[model samples]
Target: MPAPELAAVPGSQDPAPAETGTSRPTATSTGAPGGDAPLGFTGAGTGEVSSGSPDAAAVEEPAAPAEEAPPSTQDSPVGSEPAEGAPATREEVPTAAPTAPAATPAEPTATPAEPAGSAATTSEAAAPAESTAPADSAAPTDRAEPTDGAPSSEAAAPGEAAAPGEAAAASEAAAPTDGAAPTESPTPTPGPRPAPSPSPRPRPTPRRQVPTPAAVAPAAAAPSVVAPVDAHDAAEAAAWGRVDDDGTVYVREATGERVVGQYTGADTEEALGFYVRRFLDIQAQLALFEARLAQITPKEIDQTLATLTEALAEPAVVGNVDGLRERLEKLRSAAGERRKQAAAEREAARAQAVAERTVIVEKAEQIAEQDPARTQWKQSGQRLRDLLDEWKTAQRTGPRLDRPTEDKLWKRFSHARTAFDRHRRQYFSELDATQDQVKAAKEKLIARAESLSTSTEWGRTAATYRELMDEWKAAGRASRKDDDALWARFRAAQQKFFDARSAQNAEIDAEYGENLKAKLALLEQAEAILPVTDIKAAKAALRPIQDKWDEAGKVPRADVQRVEGRMRAVEQAVRDAEQAAWKRSNPETKARAEGAAAQLESAIAQLEEDLAKARNGGDAKQIADAEAALEARRTWLDQVQRAVHE
Candidate 1:
């Protein structure tokens, strides 16, 4: 069998001693005896790396001389035995360090001693075969030096002797592989042992290695271990992430599972809880965004979506990553729909605002169109102001209107107001002109009334006052402020004239009061001549009384009716008396009376004779006839006697 290969342990090197005229061995095969296997390492460098060290290619560059490192605990026996029954002394050596001095070929090579009990297991052939080789004969054989970080195959354990059969096989295998002889080492010559130097043993430097159970001995030290997960936590982890026994953490996604983090502390539950909380935070943000979709603008929501998408792209949290992506996509769609709806609402509001503003403008226009003469100016003006206020309010509270629409409405409103104001000014101007004319006419009438008010010519002045009042009535009304003052002055002047007339009439009434008594006395005298026995005397008396009544003239107005009525009655009586006297004095009337009286007297005398006859005869029929005749004659005779007496 060929010699077993020996590789240097990580952080350690076995150096070759330098010798004069020694040739370095050339390696026919750097590969392992078996076919080289692939080590499936994907991180920190190339393939085929040792478990304890990096690949040789990574450190092939020449390095500066380094301090020797302590021997690795990984080195093991290569020839299968240790030398001289003493444990080998292991010293630290650094890889790529400068060489130490080698033992001289003339003297025996000093090998590390071996443990006493271990040497007994060796084959007895190993000792004799090692003792046969001459040290000087070995000088011609090439010694293999490690180069290009290649491992040395023939290296043996310190103080270990090789197996004779394997040494022969190695020599046979090396014969044609290279034209060099087999290397030989001289057997050690037994001699008195030299005493070890009195140097204190070096203390072992603590080596860093994979922690074992003993490493947790410190009171404060704790081991890194994954906590046992409950069923609920296990389910949660199945949905969110997976925890490996080595504390590696993975997040599950649709694409596949991916390494996200690791748990370095003892508790795996806390580590998983931390990542779960991060997922909850992200979920909370998404829920809040969904709720406020209407409040935030489309542009703002789009920006938030972009930010969230980027944040979730390579999420820090452990959860259903594919589910989160689906949720975000739905949110984006919802936001898009909301943006479209918002746009529609804005358009509708703008249209409504325009319609409302138009209505206000039309109302103002209608108010302005009303004729100022017929319009209730106060109410109309107030309505216009209210319409303007309404317009301003709509602008403030309603949606924004397009500029052209707003401007057009404003123009109409302004024009209406301007027209209304112009009409109002014109109407007041005409009213003022009319008032001026009326005031002029009233002033002239007032002046004329004052001129006639104090005149004492009662009849003429009264007529002039009546004429002035008629003129005042014909004059149009002035403004109330001027009219009231002018009217007061005119009325006072007229009152003065009427008051003077009343006083004058009162004084005349007192003067005529005595005349009323004299006229009453004269009326009594005239009334006394009623039964006129002497016509000429009655006439003469009445003539004088009538003349005196005329002289009495005007009486007090209260007494005029009584006195004049009495005097009229007396005049009617006197006329009736004169008619009677005339009848008595008239020739025709007297003749008619004398003839009737004479006829009645003759009839009476005849009837008296007939009556005497009837009385002497005592015949009833004849006597009744004679008596009726006699009564009729007596009645006629009495009427004739009265007429004759008159």
Candidate 2:
């Protein structure tokens, strides 16, 4: 059976070559396919054009047709070249263009069948549709142009030639054309077609991996056919590509057809369908990219945009690439805004980092500025180190700061740390010197305290020790380990001496305990001498008591004040009584009293004489005066008499 002829596209001056319907697109990035593999979209759009895949070549021995006309009634597409003087109604006609190699029927030969697939395409060749080809389809490399000796005109006339062994008897793809509307041809009715039975065969290269075809479709005259394809997909794919009888595949774009790749193991529909899927994959990639716009950085977006733009510049898949390019342009515009946002975010982060580093520096400065004498060097030093660590961490991981700003902050921080360290060193140095002086002073004080500790003069020794303790207190301190050891030694010396003193004092107190008791007994006896009412008796009793008190000897140091105080009280009482007695018996005082009494008596006698005369003369005033005088004289006389006798 001979391959069928293809109808011409509606707009093209020439007819189309072998091709089939393309599949509709149903995949998208918004609603992705149900798998991790992004390119293999399985949706309504996955339906292949026409009869699934491109037409594969059917090989046979070259045999010249004796009939003048072939059975094919359809018009010639790109590579139509019939046998010499062959019938115009032939089922299969060689679609070789005028520039194609003219056939030499005189000498026939055989060419091994090359792997090929159906050229699935669309009938509306004016505008391209989304392709359903596999994602790895090659770039458009259509061989239908005149530059390749395959002119973009009607298929070769009845006498035109195709490639060697490629006869018009069963050659040419039944692809739709842009030259005219598609008309029904002698093809398999649009229905379910049997799946192609594949037979593995050796291949030279691993270009496009598709199994070799061993069987043909129900249409014996058609070069090849694939599994059932959608009519709509077939119409779209017609605008994108076509297949040659030798199983060569090409994708059609605005820049014209460029040969993409070849997989001659299948029919024209499968071959064009392969490129269509490639177009779909590109769409999916774009959708996924757009979806990821939020996650990627501005720089990454620019990089990816460049890559995508480069890819779209000369895309391999068959589809409406203009739309993809337009979408990419929109993405580029959005990327500019993203870049601005990223810049703002970076600025905010950088400012925050600067503030944090400043805080660390300020804290270090505070520590450095503290008074070395009062500063807690251990804790403050640790804190300073922690600040430094924080500063380093910010430098390594945080957003970069401007050079001047970073340098200034680093200088301040470094200076603060340096100052703090210097202060610490200086303080320890001074402390060492001061501690040495203090240790010497304390050593001398300890020696003094030890010297005084064992002295038998308990009072003087204790007072000296108290003075030593005061000097020790004023001596300040030494290093901790040295101070502790020195203090223990001093305390031991003081304790030993003091222990001996305490034992001696205890014996003395015991001996004096008896004296204290004896003094107390004598004090009671002297006091019993009734407050010196009888001065002589008091004097005699106190004399004996004083002698006894003296004989009692010294009391304990603690009881000395108390016992002596009580004994003195008794002696003082007795002395007071005796002094009163001596005052009463003094010769001058007695004579003064007697003389006073005598003067008063003489005055009374004179008054009595005046009174007697007044009485005899009956004078009331004189009698009253005389009576008062006599009374005073009598009182004076009694006192004088008593004084003289005492």
Candidate 3:
């Protein structure tokens, strides 16, 4: 009994009750009986106790009588003697407690106490040798714990440790003893069990040595005391159940398990909504990124570098990782080009503004430089006003300009306009005064011309009028009404003088009419002398006629030419007679006359000679007759003078 109890003690420091039996023999073969095995008293073997305990002889006493006849094959109690040449023994109890009673002697009354005691002693002596028999046998090494001496305190009750070895014994025991009472047995000595602390043990059973699926199935089907689960196990259990904070469950039928709900800071509904929103946001961002990538596809790497540079320049969030990276890459190439474009635009705008400002300043300066005294300045002033209006209108509608420049330009323009307006107004006012003076001067000149209109000295009055007219012209423009009235007055005065002088001349012409008739009668008497043949008589009569003509007054202005022509002819006859008488009386005059006649004859002869030469050359005969006539006249005059002298 002690040997079996001793074997019931677990050999290992903390032996699992379920694994104790299977591991015992091999553990014992390592040479230290019960040393290498689990120390649990739940499944101690008889041989193990005989080898481990010095008191095996005494402990085996009680089982000697019952097992005396089957000494060679019967299992021994705890605390038996060691056998020679036998394998070392383990302290694990067998799991054959239900079969133990059948292996015991059937008739306990028929057996003598001395023989039973001696049988127990002999069993103890043979325990070590019997323990090796199972190892040598070809049967499975794992066995059920013996009920005869199993430690009730160490091993689980019949329902516990329902592993294969123990379960088979239980089924066998249940078939015949269904209605029998479970016998009360002494509590076996306590043995060490595996650590009861739920902390994970580092040492694990080798996978190959672990129970096969078939072997573990029977154990799993049986009811047994389950070890308390650890936190990790509880988590795994929760995962299997698909339990979440929001109480949602998700099962996966294919896996025959539950899908764990993802851990979220909030409840299921809220978390789901958040995730949905996040997913949509991510999708939207991805779409935007794709669009941006397309826009920059020409130089993808450069575009990405540029984008990254831009992203780095600004504040950004962690969520913008992809965008930031792409942006920086884009910036690498695009930065210079963008800068150049921007700079060019800036410069162009600046130049345009400067050009506009220069035009404005130049216009204002031109206005300032204008001479206020000139009429052209007045036109310039008006033009400046127009320019100012244009400037103001442009300020309201033209291109954008810097405020300071606009203000400065406006100031210059306003100043120039103000000065011009003031000067123009002052000039016009002074000109009006000058015009008033000119108007007074013109009025005085008109009055002076009118005063001289009735003067009898015609030439002197006309000369004064002419001088006033000259003065009037020399005077500048007067007020429009005054100038017109003054000119009219001056013309009226000159008309009055001319009208009086014409009337006086008409009266004088009427007086000359009577004198004209007397002169005409005398002219008729003188014209009658033309038919008289006595030269002396005609000459004497012509002298009287000329005297009468001189004594007679002028003829009518219209008949003056007729009367004078008749008188001149009568006078010419008298002169011709006197000249003829002189010529006839003077020989020297006749001689000189003859001499001129001879020179004329000589000129005529020379002209005839030339004419004859021209006739041979087809010259005209008319030219020769003119030369002959001229010579004959000269001879006739010379002869008449000679006859008069003789």
Winning model by TM-score? 2
TM-score of each: 0.43, 0.50, 0.34
- In the range 223-289, model 1's lDDT, one tens digit per residue, is 2121222445334644678666644556778888765543322245544543454455456567788
Give a tens-digit lDDT track for model 3, residues 1-646: 2122111111111222331222221111101122111111111222221122111110111122221232232221222111221221223222222323222222212111111111112212221211211111011112332343433212332111122223222322321111111111122211223454353221221233223434433322333221222334233322323324422323223324332112222343332221122222223333455455424434553443433333233111112334434544554345456556655766787667657766866787777767766548756867776776766666666666777877777778777767767877887798799889988898788788788888878878878888887888889887687778777888888888888877765665688777787887777788788755678888777777677677776555567787788777777776776776666678786677767767666776776676667667775775577567656766775675556445
Q: What is the lDDT of residue 129 in candidate 3?
A: 16
lDDT of 1: 0.50
Worst 10 residues of 2 by lDDT: 120-129
Question: How far in Å is the alpha carbon of 244 misplaced in model 2?
Answer: 8.1
Question: What are the runs in model 2 whose C-alpha is more than 4 Å off?
Answer: 1-269, 450-454, 519-551, 557-646
What TM-score would you give candidate 3 relative to the actual structure? 0.34
Best by lDDT: 2
Q: What local lDDT does model 1 show for residue 406? A: 90
TM-score-wise, the better of 2 and 3 is: 2
Q: Give candidate 3's whole-model lDDT.
A: 0.42
Ranking by lDDT: 2, 1, 3
